[model samples]
Target: MQIISQVFQEISPADFFYRNKEIAGFSNPARAIFSAIRELIENSLDATEPFGILPDIYIRLSSTGETEEEGFYTLRVEDNGSGIPSEYIPLAFCQFLFSSKYKLKQTRGTFGLGGTMTILYGQITTNKPVEVLSSTGDSKIYGYRLMIDIERNQPIILEKKVYENDGQWHGTIVEVNLEGDYSKAKPKVIEYLKQTAIANPYANIMFVDPKGRLYKFERTVSVLPPQPKETLPHPHGVDVETIYRIIRVTKCKTLLDFMQEHFHRVGRQIAKSFLEFAGFPEDTDPKRLKPEEIVKLVQAMKSFNGFLPPDASCLSPLGEEILKAGIMKELEPEFAAVTQRKPSAYSGHPFIVEVGVAYGGKVPVRSDNDITLYRFANKIPLVYDESGDVSWKVIKSIDWRRYNVEPGMPIAIIVHICSTKIPWKTVGKEMIADRPEISREILNGVREVARKLKVYLSRKEKVKREKERLSVFLRYLPKIAEFSAKLAREEKVPDIKNLLRRVRRFGEG
Candidate 1:
């Protein structure tokens, strides 16, 4: 019997993602267009917030072909933010998994795949290079037309130009052409921008659609949320692969020094104790550790006690005041309440939860009798996968009746979770995993705001009842007064207006 040989080959990150575009949320033409817009806008927001600047973002979509589904469209997005350095433009747009966001902090894009994947989709569909113009507050602005080398996972620069700047221009502008269904994607894209405005209140976003329809979401405030701080990994969350990578890259000579340097809340004493528990010498070189030693170190870190829960300084949660203001500004609700939960942890990564509830006024009732839950992770809106998210589960478990909310009530619930690392259940980054600690924090936050809503609703009901009672008394008071006047043999009916006024004052008091 003859045996056949098997051939194996390694693939680049770009090639792999190109073959499986669905994982990055570019499964269809309409979704690809929406994803492209989202990625570019999110990148702009991330860039501007770090500088504490109110973002001014502009987006334009124009069709270059006939049919909507089979048409090619050009999308241009420009932002007023801290621009990328000229040297990094190619790698930033053309490469995959090369991101400055790898640090432990609350950021919008987690995997560093969104921006590049968008361009990759455009390239594969329309065979057009992406154009990027940027300036880092320098004397000159740089422009480049580049394409991705999928197999090499690198940028292939086609053209480069430089222009003298007036010192006032600083931001990024990206333009790409892709086959898309703008007609189908128009509503979703607009909704995304609108929700983004509500979540960010400090951003002014303007969009020009394929039909030349201009839409603008103006900023409501000048204040920006606090930027998230970079943090070290927690010992409890580290595994064999993470340990190996840390050991390989660490500059510390000794195992104890490496542990203390790489992990948060692990000081000299904690590191020494951990080494002792792992049966390793404190002064042993971390780079010389064998595989077995690494496994023991990971187990020791996991089982070790006395290390404080991971520091929460890395998270940047929207405060209750800001969240409520945003919800009211967007929904125009008659009553609104917001709560920010204290710091919590899941798998040793610290996180914070915030929730807001808005009722009545412009808030629309759902026809399906489902609560309107606006979910956000790390301040970025989660538009899809509502039923699969942990926040949705928490919402379903809530008894709306307890808050005096009914099936067709005009209410909106907003939830935001900020963490160094969000537990996303899918590669698309559209849904969050149902971690128990995260669920508890979300539930508590929502319940806190719901209690406030209950009070408001109760007061509203009381006022309604008072008005009804006053109406009934007004309807019957004249007849009663006439009868009493006749019985008393008086020629004129008694004036009860004064009595009515006094009664109203007493009731109000």
Candidate 2:
């Protein structure tokens, strides 16, 4: 056997802290696109909250140069909402892997890692810089602009420009250059923009191509999504290491007090239950417990009953109305519906789901092309490849042929789910838990909407068929008139054609 000491060789700092440096350094182009878009979206959502304005967001896409590898694409996203404070510019724009927004409840970005990754992605792809223009309510602009190095994972401050625009400045504009074949990624970029417009019906968006083509999406509603709530950590969720550290370091007399100080959502009811079950009084000195007693108490704490479920007070979600409006805007449909599932308790925390679907018309149901499927855990859209997402999986399993949707006809569908613990499959946040319970909930909710859609389509088809039959009968009227004229001229046939003409005229009349 190898020596125990040999296995514990010296390790470098870079080895542990810079893990996944490539991904952290510069992500793939498609992922970068996803990242960039996500950053702009997050900023827009932030602006729309609090003041309760239906968000007005704009996305513009343009390509420079003709050659594939030599070509360049720029995506510009602008949002007219609550702008960032001038003082927070450095922390909001330049900092890497840092987030000022964090709460215990369901939020889109708990880690605050997404936005920086976007700038990093652009830096890696272009080896250049990114520009930003942000302003608060009628305040002078404080733009903390910079260029990032992908290889070194460093930010280089470029220029800090003062604002000169005359209008009330309450928005931000972000522009970035990245190496991409815009021709290839154009469809996807457009689809994403349109879907975003639909999902955020309260937000107005506009896109202009490099060739001078423009696409604009405006919100029809006046309502904005709800603001996010703060969350608290679960007491039971703390590991053994955490509890041991707390017991050793805390000055509290009882375990209940320690729980209250360190853990969140832990009320007196739960503390009393944990103490009673552990055979400890509320006032028992935590320092007095022997090792055996501690073990017993820990076990009892684990088995404690009637612990209040995790409160969803901190969970924030964009309301169903707004989410549906945004979806229907891009995936225009004859029938569109949204369903928000009741809050569900999981591991003592409450979670919920909001699903939206649009049936009829062409929403491009093609396997070769990535279908415009949008998923938001809370209110943030997952921007990675959606081929293997839960919604895509459900789409693949469903029999679309029955709906008379020819192979690649457009069929738009959008889904959003909110929970304290999202079973996200990747850092890209593209896939969700494939477990039976989650899958079952998603499938059932979508199927109900699909059922209603199928009925609507079938009725429409029936109306179309009836119209065609009536048109065919109308086409015979002229021929019948000619025959009647011939019979009248022949006379020997007793003018049968005349009789037929009369009958045809009566029918026409």
Candidate 3:
């Protein structure tokens, strides 16, 4: 561990964190497909906004190869989402750690990690470039396609072009050439896209395969997931520097107003309550409060139990309708859809979950493989290897066959959280590790959902099968008709034949 830390310390910040070869190489073709598509998907989501205009995304897969080559492929994703402004084009393609939206819990581009990684990976693997065309509201369209240096982490501009446009329209078009085997990544890509579609059903997605095949996933509904509320800095959440700044700029002469402004979920009444708890008067002027009174306010704040739930309005909720749209769009529409779940608590976390179950759809049957489960933390798709995931263990423990769901046949669930910190193991923000405590917490959370669904489906399937059985019995009547006609021709049992003839005559009558 010491050696590891020493080696880590020796590496430059960029080499150590942003452009690590090992981290970049962890993306196989399957994972790469997901990463590439997710980058574009987030862009699309950002474009379609509070205006409620349903965004249209088109994915075109062209086999850049005329020959029988498997690796030469180009994938294009075009979206009518809010396009990148012409001025920010360079920053959008080149910048990392800007994370302007990082503090935002609801918006999509928290890390600015996903898109930049795609550009980096494509540059490294194919030694090829990527192209991006973006337009702002009523702005001229700017197109940029470039490759970045892995060692230096800078763009090697391959193309800088623009399209004439008016400000009335906005969107982004991105295309990349990758060296990995596109065919093998097809199913995983399809599955990932399908889930993304279900999750964002309000958005329309179109995908084309390298074989010139096309797939389009769109949301039929116009309702979008709610936007995250604007956040105010919480005093407890602030660092020392920020706290000092607030202290310097505070206009209210007392600590009471300071509490209301800096801390989250605490209102003026709550701040007043805290002051009273600390033995200060409710009407005490904030600017005139004594230093001792301020200390009391701080003490009362630490003890207050009724502080409004962490101003979660700043956190976005992935509505049930949108999630299902995301799923049905990418995957086959034959799923048993459950949109949103009531908010549930776990380990002091306040989260809302939306689950979609596809029993037997167009999903493939695997070669004795465990079922493929896609796990997302805070709406970000995680690509960690499945073996280490806690959800996979819970999945394995249950007998999936009982639900008429085979290992490979379109069987999966989705979990979304709205908390400050997800309990995921890595910064990639994918799956939860298989620690017993966390595993138990997640399993328990999903159990109620599973139990209710299982009972509901079991009864539904039983009724369906009973109808099928009756239909099967009805099929024998035709055979019986043929046999009765032969008996009439032979006249083997005169009395029995006579009775059958009478019955046939009655049927005819």
| Candidate 3 lDDT tens digits, 246-288 | 5667766655676787667667888877666667655555555
TM-score to true structure, per model? 0.95, 0.74, 0.72
Clash totals for all models, in order?
A: 0, 16, 28
lDDT score, candidate 2, position 267 = 72
Best by lDDT: 1
lDDT agreement of model 1 with the native:
0.88
Off by over 4 Å in 2: 1-27, 50-53, 59-69, 72-76, 125-127, 147-158, 161-168, 235-267, 278-280, 284-305, 345-349, 367-374, 395-410, 457-509
Which pairs, if any, clash in model 1? Answer: none
What lDDT tens digits, residue by residue, belong to model 2 across residues 1-90? 785664555533222223443443224454455456666676676666545766677776566546445656676878777677766655
Per-residue lDDT of 203 in model 3: 71
Consecutive 10-residue window with the lowest summed lDDT within model 3: 6-15
| Candidate topping TM-score | 1
Candidates' C-alpha lDDT: 0.88, 0.63, 0.61
| Candidate 2, position 252, lDDT | 87
Candidate 2: what lDDT?
A: 0.63
Off by over 4 Å in 3: 1-14, 17-30, 49-51, 61-72, 126-129, 145-163, 233-253, 272-304, 324-339, 344-350, 358-374, 378-384, 393-412, 418-421, 433-445, 457-509
